[model samples]
Target: MTYDDLLRRAAALARPGHRAILGIAGSPGAGKTTLARRLVRDLGDIAAHVPMDGFHLADAELDRLGLRDRKGAPETFDAGGYAALLRRLRDERGEVVYAPGFERVLEQPIAGAVPVPPGARLVVTEGNYLLLDTGSWVRVRGELDEVWFCAPDEEDRVRRLVARHEEFGKSHEAAVAWVLRSDQRNAELVAGTRERADLVLTAAQLPEP
Candidate 1:
């Protein structure tokens, strides 16, 4: 399917009386965030983007836990907190719900950053572990109305991931090493959950940002 078809399907999930949450799950560099952002932008007022990256554990906390090196791993995030927020979003309690936002430059999560107004009928959330069945990640699937998985070509995904790391201040060599070591492991884990998704998307289905 084309990107337009995906948009139409996502938009159709929003009924007049019910709120829907659409989850975009993929490995690192699979373009989950890009797709979610595009969906929200195209959907406009009826949709809101609430990324799971917002639930990343603080850098200090990561150091305390000794998981700083595995920053993008599932364990590095506050999985329980993320699940709780999704529950709150699903409940639609008629209040403005505030979610954290991750700053790529600072590599920290800003608290109460993204506000989801009560009027929004569709919530688009994207992240790596959304489809994972481990621990608190299992709770995420229940809250989401539908979850779509994205799988681009492995070489392209790795290239994008390396470029992203370099753009965020890592040296080219360091970015390549990080992608091969840290991000690749996380990607493998995420890839195992592809079968659990409601739909699987490919690069052909995505549009350029």
Candidate 2:
């Protein structure tokens, strides 16, 4: 889909006093966050980002659970907490609603960093597992007005993941290793959920508007 197409869909879903939740789901390094950021930028202040990454368990917690090596795996995140936040952000009436934000430097979820004021119209939530059929993820789909799956070239996605890891302080070998062993596995799992998306967009198809 084109960028203009996204804008139109976002606009149609924007209603006063109604929380609009749009899910952008894709494989690791598929530019899900990049697409979400662009949508939020185009949609302006009426839209706020509430990423699924914020549900990631802290590195220390992962270590305590003996799942540090599988950091990005489906079971490594707080899926229940994420689901509850989505429900509250979409259903409950409140003056101020707060959501967790992921800290890349610390590789942990920092509580209450994203504040969704009482009147936010659109919430662009992106993540790999939003469409997963497991557990609470089933409830996630029922809450979204629409869901778009972003697909980039597989090679490009892998390269981006490797580059991202290297930029985040991992050695080249470690970056590649992690991307192949963990990130790629997660990617495969997310990719399987494409059928659940309302639209499928290429990275280049995003419009400037």
Q: Each candidate: RMSD to true structure? A: 0.9, 1.8
The sequence of per-residue lDDT tens digits that candidate 1 reaches over residues 1-209 is 88889989998998887789999999999998889989999999999999999999999999999999999999999999998998888786498999999999999999999999988999999999998888999998889989999999888899999999999999999999999999999999999999999999888886653
TM-scores of the models, in the given order?
A: 0.97, 0.94
Give residue 53's lDDT in candidate 1 (0 to 100).
90
lDDT of 2 by residue, 121-207 (tens): 888999998888988888778788899998887888899889889888899999999998988788989989999899988758743
Query: What's the lDDT of the predicted structure labeled candidate 1?
Result: 0.91
Q: Candidate 2: list runs displaced more than 4 Å.
A: 206-209
Q: What is the lDDT of residue 38 in candidate 2?
A: 86
Per-residue lDDT value at 88 in model 1: 89
Q: Candidate 1 regions off by >4 Å? A: none
How does each model score on lDDT? 0.91, 0.85
Which pairs clash in model 1?
A: none
